[model samples]
Target: MSIMASRPVPRDDASWRRRRLGLFSVCLAALLLPICFSGGAVATPAIGAALHGSALEMRWITSAFMLAFGGCLMAAGACADAFGRKRIFLLGVGCLLLTSLALAFSRSALAVDWLRALQGVSAAATLAGGGASLAQDFDGHARARAYGLLGTTFGVGLAFGPLLAGLLIVRFGWQGVFAATAVVAALALVIGTRGMRESRDPAATGLDWPGTLSFTGALASFTYGVIQAPALGATAPEVIGALAFAVVLAVAFVAIERRVAHPMLDLTLFRYVRFIGVQLLPVATSCCYIVLLVLLPLRFIGVHGDSEVTAGLRMTALSLPMLVVPFVATQLARRIPSGVLCSTGLVLAAAGLAWLARTVGAPDTGVLCPALWPMLLIGAGSAMPWGLMDGLSVSVVPTDRAGMAMGIFNTTRVASEGVMLALVGAVLIALIGAQLPDMPGAVAPDVAREAVNRLVAGDMHGAMARAPAWGEAALRSAYEHAFATLLDRLAIVTLLCAIVVFACLSGKTRSGATDTADLGEPSTDTATP
Candidate 1:
């Protein structure tokens, strides 16, 4: 029997109360993911300052968490189904509480990094188990609303995380940020223990151990290679070995998935053209919107010398559109074809990126004024597909494989975010390195490279100390030049992705109908979260 079918329906008033309480607990736990994600970015410079970490070490503060969270999500979901959702959910929340508490007291950057990775593993379990629990508890309209609230909770966390973290940091230092998440996690644990029920899939197969290990290893290896390249040199033996190992592990993962009885990822899903198009939506947003959540904070607080509070307040322009624009896009999807609506939104974002690139480095313009409109445009544009992609993930696939499709789509969405963050940081570092030699008061090539690494790592004081010849003004100018170039390249990439998405999605339908007919599936109330 299916998992949901096996669970007895709640009939009594007390059972319903427990279900509601379970959902609140799940949502409470869900809020921690984004809070940790965005808040970590704001906390990184401070962490480095306090811990006396290097550029690559400082990057790990955020990277380790994201990479671990993304890599383990599929495995976590499988475990949730094979064991019991409530069992996994409680374990996850309990671990999260422990990790957050540990992070608050950690003395070293390396300790924080390792703890962050553990925290991410816990988060993956929490999300996978909590989402599965909700799926089992609700059906039809109720399921839709439950997931909707889950999505909104995530949005709220992303929108205000920096601001909240900034306030906490100002009042109580970096530890306050982790302490805040720990407090919320404690609440989630208490409620979940009191209310959540056990449920599991009777027909679930053995976990894909090989696939899980290989996939996680591949992502970690690849991200490490990328993030360390600028510091270790592209030709360094360690960088070369890591990249080569990543390729081998990736090949092994695909082979394992193809051979396994119940694969973590069904390779067959890639055969669908629309599935390919749907997956691109996340990649597009990762470039245009998600990367900014990390990079912009570094620019404002680290490079431009704004206070953490000012930087967080400035970030609201980039994140606030997430709260309102997705609803507008959903309403418009009823009239416009999904492909067109999505492509148009990307086009707007591309234009904004290009605009921001041109204006961001203008010396005379004020900090917030130069980037404000572009940030709004990019946020609003990216929000167009944010709500619809989840529904499209299932609708484009056969009904029997909808579950696999959703899992794959979410994994791609999240895994790509971690990969892109690493890739963009690498690219920005390279661009900055290239600009350093040409600036006035330039130092030796080796010294310049070290300074660039420190600059991009969000250690402005350390960077200045490294290259005393290049005053703060010259260092900032070079960084501004490199940042503008990086944005231009990102804009081009986003535009190309838009074209590919439009082409793949155009003139396709479930029953040989127009795009508008199929588009309605994603707009309906019954759509998946």
Candidate 2:
């Protein structure tokens, strides 16, 4: 090898300071984004009851936020590349701050939902721009370390969100969650505005308005259709119409993207099987694991009768490993292939979920500690590939398109998790309702619906009070049974996804493969860099 090839690239002190600022700012935003939503899961019961909301309305509180965030991500990414990353990022932080403050004072469920959706859009801007900032400023080992730290920060938010929210909710109610989010975002905005420099794609022209609209329309329509299916029935005209409209918009989006000079998403990237495999990791986990993070806390409070704080603490078994594994995986990637590591981690997750299913089916045990062992395994396995996969997914992409690529990547991930939460809620309610037919007042549809909603919303005491004639033991058994069945299905599906990921990322390819040595060419995203 030539000496020129072996020597490190030179960077001035000012350049180092600028990149460091960008890294710090983006990672802070990443850390706070998950906390903005995940922490609220522990406070759901309080939010629902305080607003006098039903089960479906409560689902919207979370799903609506995710939907808006996912739907706007690509457009936000394009805007970041065309305009400026620092500018867009600061704007997003401002939006986050304002919406969070409004949510803190929101009196109605509908108002909260709207605020949450706005928050999602702001989050989309921050995440898209933040990712682009890191990709634009760093390359080689520095890039790997920045991505690893970002992943770790993201993991910390997911892990600690509920725990922190639990304490806040106990101290100051559900509104405290939103209030806390605002304060953190306010701090980020101040730091980012002072330290961050502007970065954008010099070659980028005007935004792809047509493509952006079509894609957003498709996603929103499809999500609405699925989310409303349980209440309106799958065949209802509204549901059917929305779903059909989504299909049309999706087709239009593809056509527009293919023809446009500056497309929002570059479809050509999908040709790489490794790219496809890395993207699937989020989807697979969403279907098999992320749903549990939302639902399990409800189970603890509703079924097992644990306090909000206790329930959140109990979840440590599921979240703590993520804090450690992703950071460690950055080092481990040096010795192991990313594909093998990802597949192995997912396999372990599947096994842990299977154990959880069996434990839930025991019918006699009410304690949660028995299941902690499997939860630990599930968390560890899920964390192992996150940093590695995230780095690999963008590293292989042309540096110029990294912003759009990361946006698309995270859009699918967040959107899938949102969709899964809705679907799983629907399924759980259906399973619980199936058991309702044998209970007292089965002939009264309104009574049955109320009972089911209350149970699902983590208001077990209220559910029992509302249905005194219905035996407590029977209600408990039915919910436990439904939860167990859900876990069983998740375990099987996750295992299958792991196998598919392993196959796609297994073999070497001419372009690149999923290993430590394949960081690819230096980014050409910024003309001056």
Candidate 3:
């Protein structure tokens, strides 16, 4: 296999460049995928004064899509394997276009909520399918580079979603963001139709309806419970039922997956210590990554009296790193093991979070400054693991079962992101409830603060406008406390990564072949078509 002895490999620089460029298109498509989640919430405060939408309604606009998007990955991943990657990708893009159009024309909060959910579901298919395609499309070392490129695109999309939305929103209003996103989705569909080739694992058959149904039901119930618990109250019947149903469905799903011939989700992957630990990445990522962004604005308003426009601009710090660093890190990871990079990135993120946590008492401008670097670290760290794990995940499964393996990966990433956010959100609310004050003319201080929480949580604009005499100051205190509580979120992520690597580094720190060997090699692993 000496370089000179090997047969001359053909090279097509133009095609190479074109394929390289395909990565960017995927990123552009991803950029708006997650943006749909925050559509109403991000828009509400900035224009709430003008639009007069309820804060609760806006929050739903932000969170509802996440639930739907996460709830469908298992099915979508299987769809990619069965129908073919490029074709399914087109379908996803088509759905995204339609949903974005619907969102653009949404007249009321409810319509926006439903459309956002649809947008999220479409985005989920795109995320899972597009990612899987990158794997099937690239070969050898090129695969790693493609992975990095894909990672960069995802990071860029997440980072730019807010910035782009902010600009369009400012220039043409909120609907502008929707319209622009629709155009992007429509263009993606066209490009995919023309250039992308279909990739279906010929051996991948036996669609797992039972597994899909059971897992979907379980996850849907769980996501509903988490999203609704805050608004529904602890004892609310819907929340309780959702939680109970989730628990039962999860147990049933596990039992079913163990026995089903072609299951929606296979449970044996968990036995691979590396996959199990890496799985935690999603939980940590979803819980801590966006949770603060969700809450940080309250700090800006309460402490510095900054407008929503200003707060959104400042968030560019977090978004920018998330976008830029992945492009850099993904390249470097070709040489460096993802674990070393991941550990280093987490340390950096922990430092950033620690600094951010310490600045809670400072001015809004100063307090948020600490977040910039950690945001970068988080972006890089997030990309590093995926660069390694995804390749490893795909390669380990038997060729016939590749679709199932990928489906699990996609389902876990989205589902955990949603659940983790809920976990951290609950912790933040429980710990930082002290910062919120009662709205105008409330009786008990605690109840009043909860009301403010409801208000801030509901509509900071309206809350700020009708706040009690001590509202601003009280809200500031609540934010300070919340920031303090955010430390717990960071600490959890840091501790989880540290513990997993320290304990299981021997398992996950190896090459793909090594991981497969250690995991007792899956029964039906396959090669690219």
Candidate 4:
């Protein structure tokens, strides 16, 4: 029996044309999802400068979107299956169009943060519904090809988003970033409206409301506490309360998932050692790679005084390997054990991070600086598991549970990215804050704290304006030190993850099979929604 579903080919040429058009529409919409994620980080400095957003508000501009997107993703897929794929897809595109347009005109940071969250929700719907619709429209070989193209489109967006946003910002300012997203959303809406066919799963057990709410609440609360910790002190009542609430909700979510007839996440899957190893791949990448995508842009544009275009070009070096290295990793897996390949990749990334930390503050000569090699190394290293994680996600579980396995893997990947981004940003702020008082010409304690907030928020000009005592040179030096320290910590975490993943996957399975046999051929089906 084949792993993929089989569907009858459309007899008429017109039906085929419609399906092709639907693929293009969904692919276009899918492209915007990563752009929204990566581009927001590129635009953060400009947004902070224009809106005069405080540290917390600036963090929310990015965090709010990510949290909402990750929290709503699994539920959106369930809604698509239970309700109607085309209906939800169109609704998502329409809402995205509205939110993007609103975001383009918004003047307040708070308003932008709220709008970005809505955009995240809309993007989730677009991804889930659009993907499910494609699964319905084609199957077998055609399904594989369509999904392969969709995945490539997503990769392209992630790789080039910063560069594109930088070009737009340079020419039309920050609003141009949102304006471009709106244009893309509008095109997707028109094409999708004409081409998409409605479909729903007959056996769908409906949305898991309790589990969804609890999981979302837990993530949002935890993220809130982390992002606010620097500003409100870790022991502040609000911070402590939010953390406590998040813990309670997380426990509730676990209980709800165990009790529900159709849980969004099947917790029992964790019993498989291989499954646990596969899940850790994303967490590893998030620490070593994904967090850097956001932080590097901020550091280049804000701390280092690099232009948006320059920062974007620098980021391209970091992300470009993702477009090519994943394929190379897949081929290498034919000769090497997948576990060995994954752990080796992470080790390389850890080395790259360590190298990067040492080179970041060096005088920037041009676009290609000393940091370029480290960025490329990190990208190449992380791409290895990036290629295999999807296939491993499904293969580790029983074939009948492939869809559930895919969902859990993706949720772990995305949710971890969001959480890590928030945690790292908070840590960076704390690290910078700690360095401020010790600087040669440090200001008063209160003023130094405010400077730390502004500095971490990517408001370099504002920070200097607030604390002239700590001169531009001293401030920059402090930021460089803090950023390097954060990178070192991340490197250590990645190395630790690599060790655990290797152990979990290197061992023989219960069936007395070597893990390398599970590598097989890479799955062409899209595991992400």
TM match of model 2 to true structure = 0.88
Cα lDDT computed for each candidate against the true fold = 0.87, 0.78, 0.63, 0.87
Off by over 4 Å in 3: 1-27, 37-41, 44-55, 135-137, 297-309, 323-337, 365-387, 392-403, 432-441, 444-450, 453-458, 464-470, 507-512, 515-529
Error of 1 at 193 (Å): 1.4
The better-scoring model by lDDT among 2 and 3 is 2
RMSD in Å for all candidates? 5.8, 6.6, 6.2, 6.0
TM-score of every model versus the real structure: 0.93, 0.88, 0.83, 0.92
State the lDDT at 233 in candidate 4. Answer: 78
Model 2's lDDT to the true fold?
0.78
Model 2 ranges with Cα > 4 A deviation:
1-22, 361-368, 395-404, 439-441, 465-471, 509-529
Tens digits of per-residue lDDT for model 4, 195-259: 99999999999999999999999999999999888777788899999999999999999999999
True-vs-predicted CA distance for residue 219, candidate 3, Å: 2.1
Which tens-of-lDDT digit does each residue in 1-529 have in candidate 3? 5866686545676556556555555666776665665444456454444445554455556566766777887677778887887777778889999987887776777677778778777887887677777777678988877766666666665665655666676787878878887898888877666556678878676467776677778877886776566655667899999999999998988888889776677676666565565565555555445655555554453345555456666666666666556556556666775556555655555566666676556543443455566555554554445445555455444445555566677677777766665665555555545555434465444444344544545344455464455565665577567767677567666756755743443433344453345445542334221
Q: Can you list the residue pairs that collide in candidate 4?
A: none
Q: Candidate 4 has what TM-score?
A: 0.92
